[model samples]
Target: MNKKRMLVSLVTGAILGVFCIVGASIRSGGEASTSLLFALWYNRIIMGLVIGLNISKKDLPSIIIRGAFLGLVVSFAYYASTGFTDIVSFLAGIIYGIIIEYVNFRVNK
Candidate 1:
């Protein structure tokens, strides 16, 4: 990806991470959350959407498959960087990407 797109992906991921942190804080009765799983879940969806923007309609399906894989890899790396080891975090990232895409399609349709 180009620098601009990479920047967008990074920023989007940061925004999503902020939301997940906020969500976790609320879920934890306003206590701050220092959870890597939440961060992984957020980054993957944002990365998927970033990659999706570069895919054409004819290649969308295959591209999405690759995008999901990339998303998982990115999330896993972030998790490792943050000292996370749960495999569930990677799975959650994949599920979140599919769910988010499905919801976006449903709404736009």
Candidate 2:
């Protein structure tokens, strides 16, 4: 594994995670519960990190597949822990995964 690539992924994931939490906080007008807020941040960070760690190429289809899978896994875990599931979270994770992979592609290119 490329250490530089992994580093890039880590930073990218962290930034994306922060943005996800911030956006949610804004959208909810700070009304979101502590548990929900934590969950959102946790999900995004883990998803981003996973994508960054695993994504090794620039192929769109591959990126989409990996992202979708990672998102599903994370979302499922959250559901198992909280007994809550939502399509939005699953979709968001996939989207974030794609974006992270694309960014990595661009950077590495």
Candidate 3:
């Protein structure tokens, strides 16, 4: 339970969540529903929190895999909620997961 790692991850998630919202709006021609925007933002935050709390191998490979796995799992909730229609977002979740973990690793190094 490294507080620094947790805080970093949470901040990363929050930042990335904003990006997700912006991307969603652009993709939807600024017509994306409010709920959808909030969900995307919230999902990243949850992903960050989960990744922050998870204790994975120190190696980069392990971190990447763990991040991707956690991303897929956490993103699946939103994907399923959308009836599995938003494949891009689901995939982005995996990438964001990797990014989050990599950032954590580098920053804490």
Per-residue error for 79 in candidate 3, Å, reads 0.6
Total clashing pairs for each candidate:
0, 0, 0
Best by TM-score: 3
Expressed as tens digits, the lDDT of each residue in 1-109 for candidate 2 is 7666677766776777677777767777888678887887777777666766673866778766776677677666655654564445556666676676777777887
Roughly what TM-score does model 2 have, to 2 decimal places? 0.75
Between candidates 2 and 3, the one scoring higher on TM-score is 3
Q: Please tell me which predicted candidate would have the highest lDDT against the true structure.
A: 3
**Alpha-carbon shift of residue 50 in model 3 (angstroms):** 0.4
Segments in model 2 whose C-alpha atoms lie over 4 Å from true places = 79-82
Worst 10 residues of 1 by lDDT: 100-109
Order of models, best lDDT first: 3, 2, 1
Backbone collision tally, model 2: 0
* Per-residue alpha-carbon lDDT of candidate 1 for residues 1-109, written as tens digits (9 for 90 to 100): 3444444445555555566555556655775445543654456546645554552323346545754665676666655765675445556555444444433333333
lDDT of 3 by residue, 1-109 (tens): 9888888899999999999999989988999999999999999999999999987457999999998999999999999998999888899999999999999999898
Candidate 2: the clashing residue pairs are none
